[model samples]
Target: MTPPAITGQVALVEDDYTLVINRGTEAGVVAGMVFAVSSGTGQVITDPESGRELGRLSREKLRVRVFDVQPLFARAHTFAETDSFYGLLRIPFVATDDVVTIDVGDPVEAIAIEGMGYRKEANGY
Candidate 1:
């Protein structure tokens, strides 16, 4: 996994709502890694001058805490925080008009780096 990454993804969600994320032993995934689940459309940015792609703007869906780990993946579940409402992140000047849901392709990003401590700002990523 890239050091710049809070690397992970939602691999499976149990009927009981347990989340299986795609990061494990080899990927340096361990118990207690906090993951932020996001499900929203991202806008691709391109350089207006040269038409080069810059980056994508994404939205945070929710947060999950890992309680177990294995060789291929890890299991996670949700918790509450003041700013996170199920998955709705508060963004200034941006209006979210659609409903979001937990799904197969939704990204599950780790909230902390290995040593850099926790990053609470979603836009910093």
Candidate 2:
């Protein structure tokens, strides 16, 4: 099935990892829904020569798992990444792991159902 349309923005990113989204049950958001966060309109790509439009650059920032759905707001937490990055270091080729945090005011869109790929391994492997 297709993912839900992006109809919300992150209202806040709590210290405890809980995120408050502007959309909730009224916007077809339900508990256990997973949302993906990105840079939103904050970044854009443009041709340097023409100074013309190219496209908005949005990279997957973080994933959130919704738990409490209110009328105008829902609570969630940074869960996992829809995409992971791995880097090789030097001759030894050490692996590098990167974790993206959902910053406040970032655009959030429903992307998957909860438990779809929930990881039980520690450190969210």
Top model number, lDDT: 1
Candidate 1 residue pairs in clash (backbone atoms < 3 Å): 38-61, 61-87
Task: Give Cα-based local distance difference scores for all models.
Answer: 0.69, 0.68
lDDT of 2 at 89: 17
Best by TM-score: 2
Candidate 1 lDDT (Cα, whole model)?
Answer: 0.69
Clashing pairs in 2: none
lDDT of 2 by residue, 30-115 (tens): 88777777786657788999999898877766666788989889998754343433212112112238645566678877776655
lDDT tens readout by residue for model 1, 1-125: 33555576788886334678988877877776778888645889999999999988877876677778999899877654434564345221212574346787688777763335665656764
* Model 2 lDDT-worst window of ten: 86-95
